[model samples]
Target: MTARVLLVTSEAVPLVKTGGLADVITALAQALRQQGVDATVMMPGYPAAIENACNLKQAGNLPELPGGPGTILHGVMPGSDVPVVLLKTERFDQRTANPYVDENGAEFDDNALCFGSLAHAAVSICAGETDLPVPHVVHANDWHAGLVPALLRMKGITGVGTLLTIHNLAFQGNFAMSAAADLAIPDSMLTPDQFEFWGKMSFLKAGILYADRISTVSRSYANEILTPRFGHGFDGLLGARREALVAIPNGVDTGAWDPASDRLTVRHFSLNDMRGKSGCKRDLQQLFGLPVDPFAPVLAIGSRITHQKMADVAIDALPGVLERFPRAQLIVLGRGDHAYEQAFLGMAERFPGRVAIHIGYDERRAHALHAGADMLLHGTRFEPFGLTPLYSMRYGTIPIASRVGGMIDSIVDAGLQGTIPDDASGILFDGEQAQDMVAAISRAFELYARPNEWHLMQRNAMSADFSWSGPAEQYIGVYREIAPVEAQALFDERSAAVNDSVNLPADEEAAEAAAMPEYMTA
Candidate 1:
């Protein structure tokens, strides 16, 4: 039988969004439902999200959240079939405008407690202690919902299974142990290796160790995380659970992200009626105030300005890029660190119409940029299955990216593979060097100069599929494997293994360890 799944994540579409996590959650949830799987998405209601997407209707109150009680509000957002549950904490969550942010634009310290509360609420629903609907599987995304699997196992919820997915391991919520009492988590869970990493409580580790099954976003990333270099220091923990871990790549929403039907794009065009795309290019150039050079190559970028995205590569290579192609232009969007902001703004000043930088996110502009640009640049230092490149592909823009992680799996390298075919989708550089980026850009420009070759690449990109249907089906398969009948035995086996590994000889040591901050190095 198809299982009823509870999709848990810190962010969801039509609500709180900072990255690809939101897109993954909403797309997968709806896709699962369409395939006859019953799924509900639970997300925190940030002000922006509530204003933009929430259609609120009462789904009853949750009186037993950790630290105190909470009122559970429910609703449906645009483009999702899953029900959204919002947890409003009287002392913590209610005061904040965003789930992950405070007034100072800093990440709230109470993230552990906030998400732990989300897990606790799921447990309550699982135990039939509340009137909310019980899902057969609790699917937790990233570190935010990491505690769900552990909490469910601790409570011995008989019929519910937990599946923890790691979207990005880098942001594992490592919070202070002083707030342990307020978190209301059991004392037995504290340790140097389980929930404790050094002296900090790692929410990611907890999910990895305790969940019935663990999954990463991409197949290559799953292999990547098993080593010291990519594991983010949790390789040993993940190594132990290798048998339980699965790697399933994410997919994009074809309709929403596609240039063919996207309302946000300045001009819509498909593979057949390709002439309109040139119009889109002209419109986008005019909008961004770049020189209207129809022959000049346009490299579009819409990403957070951070090391993870390799903004440094773009900054360092600007001079060489300008030297190589005098007419080529670069359009950048999104915001992050101050260093990247200053670098891009400085370049725009130095190179006027050739380089345009938009300080923050503008979804409408992003759509137009994707449709209009000749190439999409994604030189990420390290990425966990970036969605922008996939969007660019659907928009018929060739992608030039660093060949690492998901980029390796997605984009084909023209250098190693030799001359790109008429049906080539993109070019992948093998390293982080600016020379590598410049060389790749040079090849792209060469192709751009030849309209015939460039159109072939565009057709190749447009022919590629980015639909969420495939990934959703794979996720449903994972959920079915952990249905109630299989979940009980899995939970018991997991509990015994953990208990064996972390055998506590005395109650005093456990109590002291629990009381001491988890992040404190021994």
Candidate 2:
């Protein structure tokens, strides 16, 4: 019996992506399949998700989810051949732009009801109500799919173990306690230790309390959440489950983020070759309407413009940095709060040729920003995993990032005073002010003057292995830890046959993939 996993999330890549969650789901599913886990991705059938599905076909019908009835659509991810299960219901089919939010960025009115339907749909599939076979475990992501573990226990469905991956703890699905009845949330489960949080029902708390095992995106974040600083008022509940919590870092999609083969990069460049990056820089400068100066260093911001990301600080600090480094150009790409958007727009107007701002998200432009820039300014108050910094590093763009979450785990600072120049990937700073970011970028510029040292740091950044092979097996261990004894036997047999990676840590589990090596499909 093959150990099957149903990976559930609100978004996925190449179809819909609001943040790093989508890419993680797509890549992790592909990597899991390679290690012989029969991984199937489950998500709401948004119009794009349904349309982009490869070999789409009707799988089964969902009876009565919270909102209404739905059908299960089966297919494979377009690029990665991992199986996809979509719940196509009236609520899920209605929204077109930004799955969670509307055109103006306001959340949908019936978000609780709609996501309640998603949870019910997952349980329906697992209870053998649909044509698809029951998975051994249901792997839920973030607060969007947080209700699954609690719902399973409520309905007395005991066959499947549950694992919840907290991508961002801040976005807990907290709603009025009155809405619980419409969501079919049982009154019994509403307690301080369970779904209840300060008289309101929280979807994230439900998963934290009920899931057999829980995992955060990074190891530091796992420990960080157990404290009051990063707990978001759920520290006590999370502390109780600390023993079950694990930290599994996210993997980069090399096929999509790699500089050498990325279609959106316009020009290809790699570690061995140095000529193409200059051409890419010129192309970016031309596209963004900046002066075509190859000698000028381009500092880029490729992230959401919000308080958590400290976009306000960047807006205030950039002027001083730009004035100091006279030749350094700044490129801003991403959209969020209207105030921040307007602020960035104002910035472009103030510094005409020196500062260029594109107040929206475009995949191609994001790639170009990384390919062109000398350094990326990624400052966030808290980050589960800083994938953007990793993406920039892939293009030999050093990131001057805040020392939080995965940034601390991934970036090896280019020494305090050129101490470990050889091993340094990027610069990391531990401060939370506008001046702090300035000081960090100052260090980056100082290193930038030393061309040989800067090139060595870029080489270290590009040579990093953020691929999925290692992390996939660690997820298997978490699954096996929670699995039933009988299921564990089956899982172990399959694991041995795949790569002999049954009891290995994530870093030590990178053996040859035996079962399904062809991850991406046309």
Candidate 3:
């Protein structure tokens, strides 16, 4: 009696990844399976996915989509028990290094059609037109799978609930209205209320309009999207569906991210032991070619270099910070925005040995940064639910983050609160200005000078739980709310069994926390 869910997404970790969406989809699917929900992920068969998948077999063949016929392949996600259905078609098979963008950094010309084919396949499977098992709910993630809900409704399909989760509202899949026929979108459903957004066909608007329930990665983001600032031009439509919207914050995989067992880092350390961290710190300095000063705080930035991430602010503040603390070293890893890249490279030139910048992302180095750095610098103007700060905290690294989105939800600002309590996890600045960042870095330096206070905050961060167990349970509650009566009974039975098996200390608290972050509650 398991409530089967078809998780429609563009990417999954270990198979394909360009951003946090891949990690979120894979982890959520795996966690849902652990809780007795039959969650299966459905994604386009990019060459990387097909190359890396395990136990791959032909599930079935799909009817001709706008692109062409596709062969559905079933496989288990590498290193996890979660089942994955890959839609293999020439449209997806020929994708460049990045799924959405090509070598020239331009989006693929047929991206709308390529992702539309993915949505069509998902809707077909949910309607029991494929060899795959019919899902009780079709949960679509982001714009790539956004067309599923609208297509289902347009085709008059029923009995399956649709849930659309907006990971980031900034990247709406908007295409030329003339390409509607190429995407196989019906003319009847092209009105402003459905898929049309300012004379363009929008895949994201379709999902938001037709899905039974809408959710965002964090509670603050869900509330933020109701206004013009965060809504990305869909505030009015989102406001109309306010009652249907829910905010379920994403969670980290404790087993995969555990500092003790992580194979990516040079040295593994836990909360109890303090010796290994120093070893890691030295190793990180050597890796980045920075002067090995154990006393000099190492600040790391592991995010995309983009305007949204406020990388410009960090760039502008670095000179003042280095001047204030002569021995401070900064290490940056990520690639985005050519302007930011040039700016960071210029900063590295200005302060050789003190600043190390890597233009592209390296997973091992990111893990090392989290494990070895004394502090993580996350200065974002807007973030949906950042996984970097969560990873940093788990590695016992204090985060100096902007007070926005998930950063506000997870990090208790020691600087703002004026006390280093047991729960004080990081330093939070109020704005994206360079001066604000300077003040936050200064506060970080102040806390670093007080070893006892700094250690307390690190312990608080390490002790805090940000695992998938909490978020999975909240998702189950959403499933129960939208699922049929029989499915609800099944969910109740599974919830009891899961609770009995997992011995979770904060299951009840997590369930309550899903409604709203504790800080927001009156």
TM-score of 3: 0.93
lDDT (10s digit) by residue, model 2, range 1-522: 799899999999877788889989999998888888899999999998998989878888876678788899989988778899998988888868788888788888788888888888899888998889898899999998999999999899988999999999999988888878888887877877668898889999888888998888887566566657778897788777767777888999888898888898778989999678998899889889999998898899999999999998988888898889888899989989899999988988888899999988888888899898999999998898899999999999999998777887899987556455568999987667788889989888888888988999999999999998877878887787677666876554433322221133434323322221221000
Tens-place lDDT per residue, model 1, 16-109, is 7777888888888887777777678887655554565557765556776776776666777765557777666654446344467665458876
Question: What's model 1's TM-score?
Answer: 0.89
Give the alpha carbon lDDT tens digit for every residue of 1-522 in model 3. 678999999999989988889889999998999888899999999999999999999978886786888888999998889999999999898984889987657889899888999998887887777788888888999998899988888888877788899999999999988889977777877887778898899999999998988888777677666656667898899878877887788999788788888888877889998678888899889888898999889999999899999988988889889988989999999998888999999999999999999888767888888888999999987788889999999988999997777777889889753567667999988766799899988888888888889999989999998989877887777777666555666664443322111112367546644764333332
- Please give the lDDT score at residue 132 for candidate 1: 67
How displaced is residue 39 in candidate 2, in Å?
0.7
How well does candidate 1 match the true structure, expressed as C-alpha RMSD?
Answer: 8.4
Clashing pairs in 2: none
In candidate 3 the C-alpha lDDT for residue 8 amounts to 94
Question: Which pairs of residues have clashing backbones in candidate 3?
Answer: none
For model 1, name the residue pairs that clash: 199-518, 199-519, 199-520, 200-518, 200-519
- Computed on alpha carbons, the lDDT of every model, listed in order, comes to 0.76, 0.85, 0.85
